[model samples]
Target: MKKTCLNINATHGGFSLIEIMISAFILALGLLGLAGMQSTAVKSTIEIQQRSLANSLITDITERMQLNRLWLSGAGNSYSIDSLTDANLSIPNCIGSGGVFVNCSGEDIKNNDLYEWKQKFTGAEVNASTNGENGLVEADACIAVSPASGSDGELVQIVISWFSTVKSKDAAANAGATDLTNTCGTANAHRRQLSVETYISKSS
Candidate 1:
């Protein structure tokens, strides 16, 4: 009688080492994707918030100019500012005693409006928050008042420029695109701008 011996093994039961390795790799990739999405979402949120704030500030200054239309009229009248430092940062006193807002001359109001705008742009209104500044980054603004050709009124163009986290210089290079088109701020690829034009009727 010849007896043949058969060797059978049943030690390994569940998943193999290679299978576990592959699953770990896939899980890591999924987590990485989730982190990337979160980063992109944060950037987009900041972009929207900054743009909204810029528009609000523009509206504020334009309204102030409207109130001072009489002083803003005539071909000789102008307030074209190249940047924030292009003019003095001083503000005229318009508040009477007891924190009351007294009647300020058109010129005085204009000066005060610009001063306050700069402050807000620099995050002066920001309260104590450990997160970040409450205003635009590296803000630069220009308020150009172009008197109409025929003395109809003045054209107020508000251009606010700041550093945009949404688009970086490196990202712009990667996309082969220019981020800045207007001649405001540093006019660099990292700069973003918000502008609006409004016509203020001549009151005088």
Candidate 2:
């Protein structure tokens, strides 16, 4: 009788239950990380949008101020704040048959033709309590203006403030989120301000 070699293979090269569970756990953790990243991306997008809007608001005010520097500086008394009315701000129904202008609506003056110039930034509800026709710090231009002689300049300060949807605690909890809080405990509000002491030379 020829004794044939009988091979009895006992090598189990497959993964054990513990190893499988561990791999599954690692994969699940990776997926959760991806989800968290997606959430962060969404929040970041919102922050960018808010930032852009704030920038646009500031630009709008500055551009208008520059364009109407005469009025901004009370040049013919045509552009004075006293003349600012809903009609001049281009508010519909504010002008009657005589085209006589009246006091600007609180909302109309606060926007500074931003509502009429562009529809994109119009109707944006700001922190009404903190923001108005006056500057962000509530400085009235009419009161603040004190013409410096021989300077031939009008020092105008333009301020833009908006409420950012980004929450503080949430931002702290998630490092990826934007923190919009200011030192004055004015959380969720970002203010951009600049003072342009432009000299309105008689030539120009």
Candidate 3:
């Protein structure tokens, strides 16, 4: 009997170098996409936070105006001889109050609050100085009590404004500064408005 030699070999199933490299590249691409998405989300979250702060600031002022209706009306009447300026109205003690500030007296509206509000916000500036032309110069509320003639009501006008971190032409020019509306226009610009009107419901 002649003996025959038999040889047997097994092929191992494994990924080739090229396949491994390609898979790594694909994974890298996916990771990069995820990173980009995360970055975008962070930016959006920051923007929302800024806007929320601004809204809160505005709301606080509105409430003050409503609560201190007497102060507003009194100031309007007393300052009738003079005009409302940008400095006349301001957010009070932004830093001291941790964002809560109020002024019972009209004098406090001038600089006390503005000074504090500026310190609270990382990058914010206020320019309120009542000393020029009248007709809602730069005040959040220009309570212009209408002539009673014979009525017992008064008209109050309120105008409010706030600085925006984004949306501004000058902001585009200056990377450091930002505008809220990113557009230029009295109506479109991000601004704090003043609402003024008269009410006969109460007497001063």
TM-score of 2: 0.51
Question: Model 1, residue 143: displacement in angstroms?
Answer: 1.4
**lDDT winner:** 1
Per-residue lDDT of candidate 1, residues 90-187 (tens digit): 66778655646687776776677788778777777563444458988877787776666786887777778878876556212332232222556665
Model 1 regions lying over 4 Å from their true place:
1-12, 97-99, 127-132, 168-181
True-vs-predicted CA distance for residue 23, candidate 2, Å: 1.0
Indicate whether candidate 1 or candidate 3 has the larger TM-score: 1
All candidates: CA RMSD (Å)? 4.9, 9.9, 10.9
Query: By TM-score, who's the top model here?
Result: 1
Query: What RMSD does model 1 have?
Result: 4.9
lDDT of 2 at 178: 28
TM-score of each: 0.79, 0.51, 0.48
Worst 10 contiguous positions by lDDT, candidate 1: 170-179
Query: lDDT by residue for model 3 over 1-204, one digit each (tens)?
Result: 999998989889999999999999999999999999998788666556655654554454344434434544552432221222233445544324465444335545534433343333323233234333322222231223354566543443323343333454432233223232222213323343322233432244
Candidate 2 lDDT, tens digit per residue, 1-204?
A: 988998998977989999999999999999999999999899777667655654655466555555544444444322223211122344445544574547644343434454443333433244345453321231111102334477755544332334444444421222223221222112232332222333333223
In candidate 2, list every pair of residues with a backbone clash: 71-79, 86-104
lDDT at residue 44 of model 1 (Cα atoms): 90
